[model samples]
Target: MLLPTRPCGPLLAAVLPCLASPLAAQSTDPGNSEPEPAGPTIVVTGALESRSLQSLDTPGLGLAVDADQIAAVNAINTEDVIRYAPGLVVRKRYIGDANATLSLRNMHTTQTPRALVSVDGFVIANFLGASFDTAPKWGVLAPGDIARAEIVYGPSSARYSGHALGGVLRLETEPVSRTAVSLGAQSFFQSYRYYETDEDLFGYALDARADLALGSGGISFAWRHFENEGQPQQWRTVAPGTPYAAQATIDDALGFPLRIAAQDSVVDAREDQFRLRANQELGGDWELRALAALLLDRDGTSEPKSFLTDGDGQPTFVGIAGVTLGRSRSAELLAGLGLKGHLGDWSLDLAVSRFETLDDRSRQSDPADLATGLIPQGGIVTDENARWTTIELTVERAIGPHRLALGASYAGYAGRSRTAPVSDWRTAAPGPVRNASGGKSELIGLFVEDAISLTPALEATLGLRYERWRAADGFLQNAGARVDYRGRTDAAWSPKVALAWRVSDTSELSASLAWATRFPTIGELYQASLIAYGPNVGEIDLGGFDPDLAPERGFDMQVTARQRLGTIDLTLSGYRQNVRDTLFGQTILVAGPGEVPVSQSLITNIGAVETWGVDFIVAAEDVVIEGLSFDGNISWIDARIEGNPLNPALEGNRFPRVPEWRANASLRYAVSDAFELAASVRHQSTPERNLENSASSRCDTFFCVSSFAFVDLKASVDFGPFALDLGVDNLLGERAFVFHPYPGRTFVAGLRWTGGRP
Candidate 1:
């Protein structure tokens, strides 16, 4: 099925000012300016000015990164540009790894649904699945095309959904002010050493952008192609003293018959992206914008361990013990249209968007070892597709001393997932279809907000949002048996209040209280159950779909203070959040129909959890020297599971993957307008054990990861229309790990060219 396309002609026509009305209103005020008093005005400026207003009026903590700052970072991945933001972390394992997601204060890295990521108000999060594997498509926007990025903390605004429980990241693309063109290229290399494997790999990207003017409108286009080869990171583990190891013949190079070692693993990935945007200023306070984007990605992984042979010259390794190869290809598209205008005393903004994964196909082959080499075995193949459509309409006006705003939103999603076994790569003969699932979801939200000026130096804000969510058309199949699931529907009401007091000309204090609810994704409600095989524990059955799963609700409060003295600026904030019905996946032992013991992993609603944290930031420019500056932020968080009904022993356990302390600092020195150098450091404390807080947490064994810090240096020089940048990351060669060891010191260099006027 194809997604529906919308037309904006009628919307634009309706908002355009009439000829007679403009003449009557303008003429009457032309000669009366001397006597007319100032009244409330609706400010409808460009995107940059609009963002400034949003940052100031929002009732929460926020941070902004402009173009100059983004350029100074010289980041390869777009996510890397925000790495220094307070209380935010990007779980990017490597330069080209696709399974990256954002982690915020009190939120675990694996919780992909806790935060919202968007480009120009259009969501890029992959709602197809709920796991970390379904992170937002950050590739849609290249780093060179970003004009600014805004990060808002907490769920204190009526404009967003419960997905903002952790926070929101909004990326705004640069608009074409005049004819402009740019071309950029980057190359990076990393040397990795883990266990017995040591190797060097490299990656590169090519980007180009152009903007043109058309009559009263402008159009812009950007393209980027990236490719990379990554080193082996996964280590295969086998018991040394086991019976199987005793029988296995040892390879001369490997000292032991069976041991934990890095296999010959390698990954190669490629991506291509293109984006086009057009904007026009309709006469009389009306403007229209449209955008279209497409992305294509292909990735392949290969693992071929040392060959081992037994008697009769027959290779013994097979199945899970042999060579493995996997490949996946995917494509995504995003399109949207927006209109903003004024109608008398009311200002309105309307937007409609559609995002779709057109093709998602993957193939995997595990061959058995033979005398000739590796023999092909029947492989597994899967395909998935997802689509989302959203519509938003908002209106704002000033009534007396209060600014009132109201909005309505609708979002819908549909997805399909299927898996099958293939006999051969050439014939592609399918044997039996195994797991299959599909579902659809709908959401509707209405919200209102009022910002009132109670006094000359004090202000108050109140907001309320009502949301209705429904999941339907869900079905799952396993072992040739299919089941139709019942549909679920729910509604929630969220409220927020905030106050801001201007203590002095350069200082202010603010506080906010809010309550929000987050709903479950389609995958969490409809995926099929399966039995997984483990080397140490044999087989474990993982239960899927608990239709009765409840939503998570959070109550949050925060206070913030901002002050500036001379050339130094400081910000301090403290916050606390309490949550009910926290959802978590746990393993439990159950009895099958045959009285056999089975370990099942299922998602359940835990009782309660609480988190508290503090953040401090300081920035100074030209403090004591001519062109020297410093910027830094430090955060400390404490999160614990307060209660659990099913597992009483876990009453007080720290949250998994959340560090106690995290900090970032950077110092920059500018020799002149054309050259600059910077040094940065990042540190994080050790995290808790696992979610269950089992005895396994207290170990320095293979599964344990420790605290670590990293330092980086960057330098850039600009001449005429050309610029060159150099950087060295992980300068100390720290081998850090968050389940997987990070790369060693890496070197990067880039050249860029820019032309045309602003």
Candidate 2:
């Protein structure tokens, strides 16, 4: 069924006429009226400002963070601006971690492909891998350049694709209003202490921006350079109390004895980013906007601990085994153009965007032994590239008391990934070609939505979307073997409906229901296989591809209420979703006589899953005392797998990475217009299972990690055009693990200078 089974026709029929009657009555009134006096003229001057759809009118729960809100917090990275957002989490490992991704609702942190991220309506989520390995390039925009960020929860809007099943993050950059220049700098330090590892890490960032006004248009340019030295969060596991730990020999890798039981992988990273934006006013209420961004990132080296010995004096470890050294470089470019205007009684908007990964290269080395100074026997080099192009057109019109919108979008992607052997790890010289894979995908969607005002205080929205997706040109090459994979195509029709009732001027209640389908990405469909060796399972080949993998389909329902009482605002929301053909990685044991057992991991379809959650948010401004405020939110979620064909015994297992309870709260006090102080707290319950839900793979106490809580404090001072800010994160030094142990207490300080607007 395209829509929910519930009947909404009667409700629409009763509301539409009630909303139109008042307007009709006003137009037909025949009473004689006196001449109206002319009011003072108001001139709006700026860089081509256009009115777009508002989130408050959308079908889902939406949250907005403006520049003032962003500046009130001590945010080093752009993603940090949304760190305390309700029902959301940013999986940031360290200051310079490139794989930072976002999770919302009941989605797991590793399900990066299920969410959508955009900057100025331009797609930024990497499609090269479609998993945790491919995250949005947050470095492209500096936190200072953001004017506002909007987070829309769920795929309840016809304007978005099914990829927004988890949610969507839309970032808008600062627009040039007048000629101005700004400069900013920041420094940070952290004391990190882990099992047998202790160190102090530091980082710094520099940024500058220039804006110019020309005629009826304006242009802006921004640049940033960032560098950081991060403590080791990853460790080489030896299984506590295992025989390998007892037999392992210690070696000096970081001027200290490094044992297999307690070793860390340290990282050094840097990034450079630049962006240009221009907007112009066309004749007859038309406007044009363009944007271009470039980002470059490099991880000089990720040094692992030394764990191998040559039995002599020199250590014989390198690459994947012992003290390994790895380097990676990546570059991305994003460009877009948009046009908006009016046609008769209809408003039209058109945009075209292109995003490309210009270069993505990595090299690693592992020497046999230092005695002979021989080249690494186990070294590899990888190269991957991806490009995406999207075109969207939307038109809106009003009919009687109802507003209608129609939109069409087309998106396509092309990607290539290859891995080759390295003859010399030091020089990164190519030895022999190993494997290569490439693929292409195309998506087209058409949607229409109507907002009907049934009454002055009641509104209803009905939307439907039709989408078609296809994958083709899939091929894999290994050694002298070449294989052409079969192409796949799928189509789906999604429907959404929403109702909003204004209980009073200060209260509102809303409910929404939607059905959406998400298709697989190029990486999930065509990426080459992976292999790993385990102590218990030797030579495990995990490169199984299911060409017939089905698309995931889901239904979502949500209800929310918002109320304002004096200076306090409260919001409560509840949601439930059910999905079919959910994709997940699972392990299959392969055993034979006289050979070690092998556990092959592969992506497979799980039959069904369900998730339900409740969230509440409370905020008060200037309550009790002037300039004192409180903002907080709490969430409770219950997610479980209902069916699994491969292993029915896994049914009813809790979804991985989904904490049952999560909460965040903050209190802020403004000593004056120039000074402010704030404190925040966050907590999360322990997870119930791993990604695969394997009982045998359970960790010591919990499934994978333990419950933890953290506290943060921040202070800021403004000196006219200059500003200073300080922050202490994890103030309590809470030792928490989410796959990787989080950083301990850290300190940050920043200074900024801004020129007055012309």
Candidate 3:
């Protein structure tokens, strides 16, 4: 995603004073007796919510990308929002699409995100684990539809299983009102003027929902579609007997000698989701809710590989013939029921859900093959399906000033994949050739959390969790034998402790320590593939299963401070983490007579490592102008591997992808009763690339990605029953390259029509 553009002289000068100002006197609006609850400070992806960021007792760091600010970042998808978060990194290899990857703390290589992603509390990730380039495509979801996104960076292994090793992210959709139908349409223009190429994108969405009263129960239903023809990127290629930059751009004004591979790349994403839920109070002490949801997300793209390139310092163009990377399809379904009630002094909550997913892959050798079958091709490369059923039960009881909660959960996953029959594009053969075995994994967990007030100014929290995980073998042998390579089952216990002290009504201090664990994934143990690029072809063999492999464990400690001085609010935090039995991917060499062949790396239990960091945030409301405000946060972090066979000096090395510093600021002003304006800026420093492999030249020195800064502008107008939003993304079109070279100078304008009876 694109970073905000650099701010102008005036905007930069106004940030400090705006953030340092005292809170404005409680507004004395003519119609209201009290201010609107100070605009509702929300705390998400954290436990034990506090009034301000610093006093938050959560053990891990938390970030919330406001919808307004998200628009300013000019991100095409969700990952764009956290691309600059303290310890977060986002990488897109060839337009990620559905397979883009996001990492936290530079752990992108081995650790499955440790980060969990959920849309409305429903988990979403490449079931194979978080590292398979399965991050949700941002182009599918509209920025205008997002209410807010919360990112928690760190291993929260206790609360979640599967891919939540690095941290967790929760994206909340805008809530639907009782009865309303909203419609909106938007479009934008983008181009690299120097390249003599231009593109235009347009889309529209419709949302309708209503709550009906059935006796004493409530029922609601809601639906959304999003589409765009994205701008193409520059391309560079190295061919046989040619230098890396054999053919560079003639003028190379940008200095990155590369040719525009495509005049245009098209992106089409459509999602049709429906949710129906009925909530009812059963008798006086029992309540029940039943919900059913069907979500179908279809994304397709046409990428013309190396269609244009440089030939001897001049531009050479290729045909739009058949050359596409990924032309795939995916679908998911979820349905569930929940029950909550109270008996005496105890409260109870229970829920059950079923989830399913299907992915389809296809390709054609020649453009004419689509109609003439020039190469006789017929078969699906791979198909994956996942079925999950989960049940969770929780009970909470209050004794005096103490609250205790107990919970138990069981989850089962069944996933299977197979290749459809196919023959060479020209030859003729039918029926499936290679069928991959499917597998299943199951987990059961029990947890308890308690909050107690030791004194008027002090509070404490204690939490514990016990979990067991198991997976069955699902691999096929080269000799046509079904391989039973399932690994062993394991169990672990995790715990967390926190203390909060209220030094005064306006300030507080808190500290917490937590221990967590994560199990290895099926793909890590049995992935097999063969990849080909031009004349180079190689086999990828995921190492054999290691039943003796231990679960990765982590210990984290954090301290935080929060205070409010008049109109200004500030937060500061420091943290340290120790990880053990870290599962790292290690490349091993196999002896070959005349050539060197690289196979799948082994997933071994690496020694250990430590990470330390600090976070800072300051915000103010109503600076010089009544409706103007500003907020920002800065971060500093250090992560390293203690000692390993690869490098002993790596102990204190900085984490590869964890940038040394990152921060953001925004200024929003209400121009008139029906109009408002906003501008924002975000910046990030470069980060080390790799820390584990030292023998290679890749890590000789910490190579930093150039620093980038960007700005955005938006205006909103409310005209009675309808509202209009006009905005510009990356106003300066700086091409900052936060994670990748995102779109430059895009424009967006939308109109929303809303009407209802209160």
Candidate 4:
């Protein structure tokens, strides 16, 4: 029988009318309505040019989740909000929300994220223009401590640099308005089906902020901390089966019911962070701002190997014990001075920053079981350091129905690293290895954009950007000596054009076209190491740079229609990204040392591919009720490689890890002035394709994971001197799995007291 698609009809029918009646009685300026009773429009790095939903000017899809959304919902992290956004997919390796990987538009650009992340206008991509995996853990700022988050989807190469191929996620913390001290605590319980196990989780957050105003200048400082130890999920192991099963013939003739073994693979994580910003008006013509921040994160996990089947229909054991550790520290200093006189339309920004990261992985078997050496009995450590310096000059002027902006940027990067040799765990004879790499690079870009208000209901935007980049003096992926792959520079000129026409007072039709390019990251080019979880028995080596490699280029287009009527807002968008010279991961059979005859997988670049998809959003506020509302988003995708070439299984096959359909919905009702209620459900469909085009789950024909739906409810009440909130997530305590076995039934409670009004 086909499983249930979704159970949202009843929830929506009950909340829609309540949201409509009251809004119809209020003002028509929906743009003027605040998301919260008392709070500013949620705007941050992602929405730099737009401050409000009505004033937002963009040709892309973006989401701004305010701090209030976090506080009222008792969110766990950024993942909670992003999980409901359109065109984004997330899959967890083990379970829980801790160690999951996210993909956008079927582009697994990088192992982690090719997407860029920044805060306060500072780029968070590491030295190689790759999303810093270590950045998120700099202690997660409590939801109450956040001001807003800006998520820009689709290619934005014209404005943001690097991983702009996928998109950019910029997080902006709320500025401290007054002195305040707040504390909150929450907990949850989760379960899984395959393993027949349950998880108990708990966490808390504490925040302190102070704002000081001195001589027409202001300084604000804030600190945040969060910690949680969740229960582990049981892993399903392949039981010992006959040769028929091992040879892939079990589906032809089934004899006995399948039996499986189970193992527990749980995860634990923690984080802490601090931030300070000072803004001062220097004279009447200049404004200066200085910002400083620090962050930290740690996660631990224990996993098992796949069930080994010998021809006898008996189970054999192969276990692995290891821990993955990641640590990163970043410091940045930026000064933005806007001229108020003379060249009043010009602004200058200068920045200097440093980023450092260390990743250490250790593995071992039962120590006594040398015959089944699951983990190579050794450890791998990688140390990275990067320095960034930039100077930006921008000039903006508004004339009649036209707005012109021109900018030029010059930036330089330097990176260095060291590696140690892998030794046998039994011997423990390891000394400091030699330096593997050191490199320096420079980038320069000149950009210009013009926004023309052709008519009261129409706007046109034209933009162009010219960029040059080069890298030299880096180590080879094969640990030996540094290579002189330097003096390499390439220049590209890209353009973007967009037209937005307002079909009616509340409807808009828009289209955009652009060209974008992405360069190889330092990690992909210079870093090489052996991964344990590869197809090969020995070590899976990540190869080094191919001097003939070229930049990946793409021509992308998108069309969108958005309409707002009374209390309902609907949006439909379709996009296509045609990429040339796309780089992909390939496994190559390389000859091993001596007569070993070993094989390994290496990374390579692919020729061409087309990724296309469509997304829809239907959000309504008071359709029938006064204080009730609901919103839902859905997405569909179709992506594949052009001509079947090197990889036959993948030719004409759907891209790996790209789910065709995913959706989410939420319902909210304000019971009274001092109380509110909310309920939400999220759903993601099974994949209609292959696993990187290789294996398929025995439980399902496709690489498809089982579909699941989770429900949540929250309530808040306020007395004269204090306010309190209680929420229940995964209310049914179902043994569900989305991305992975997420926390089952869970709940959280928090309290807040507002003192004197400013």
Candidate maximizing TM-score: 1
Q: What does the lDDT come to for candidate 2?
A: 0.71
lDDT of each: 0.71, 0.71, 0.54, 0.52
> Pairs clashing in candidate 1?
none
How much does each candidate deviate from the true structure in C-alpha RMSD?
10.5, 8.4, 8.0, 8.5
Q: TM-score for each prediction? A: 0.87, 0.86, 0.78, 0.77
> Per-residue lDDT for 201-294 in model 1, tens only?
8999999989997757789998999988776645544335432334333332222233542254667888999988888889877878887889
- Model 1 residue 238 lDDT score: 34
Worst 10 residues of 3 by lDDT: 43-52
Name the regions of candidate 2 deviating beyond 4 angstroms.
1-53, 238-262, 306-323, 367-378, 528-543, 589-598, 689-703
Q: Is candidate 1 or candidate 3 better by TM-score?
A: 1
TM-score of model 1 vs. true structure:
0.87
- Lowest summed lDDT over 10 consecutive residues: which window, candidate 2? 40-49
Write down the lDDT that model 1 would get: 0.71
Q: Put the candidates in TM-score order, highest first.
A: 1, 2, 3, 4
lDDT tens digits, residue span 1-758, model 3: 11122222232223223333211111122422211221212221111121112212233456565555554454444466654344455554322234556666536433543666655444554445425444543432444445667676664323455345567766655533345455655555555442444455444445555555555566666555545555443332233233322332332333333333333335555555566656676876676676565656555545433333444443333322233333455666667677877767677778787777745444322231322212223433556676777777877776765667788888776766665444543233434445465566677888877667677656677888888988775565432445666456888888878776655444456677788887765555455543322242443222243435667788878776654455565556678877787766654444333555534345566668677877776666667778776666677777777755533555666555566676767777877778888787666675554554332312211122345565777788899878787877668876544233455676767777765542
lDDT of 4 by residue, 1-758 (tens): 01112222332323332322110111123422212211111111111122122223245555554443444454656545455555665554322233444566665523343465555455544535332142322123344545665666666435655446677666665434444444444454444334333344466655555666655566766665656655553343233443222422122111343333333445555555566666565764555555565655555544432344344654333322222222222333222222222255443444434333333232222221223423445544445565555555655566666666677776676666654544553334444753456566677888877767787656777888888887766555334434556558888887888786654444456678878776665555554546433364333243423544567777878876554445555556788987776665655444555545444444456667788888776666554789776667788887777643545555676665566777877777878888888888767655533325544421231113545566888888888757778887778765443324556666677666545334
RMSD of 4: 8.5
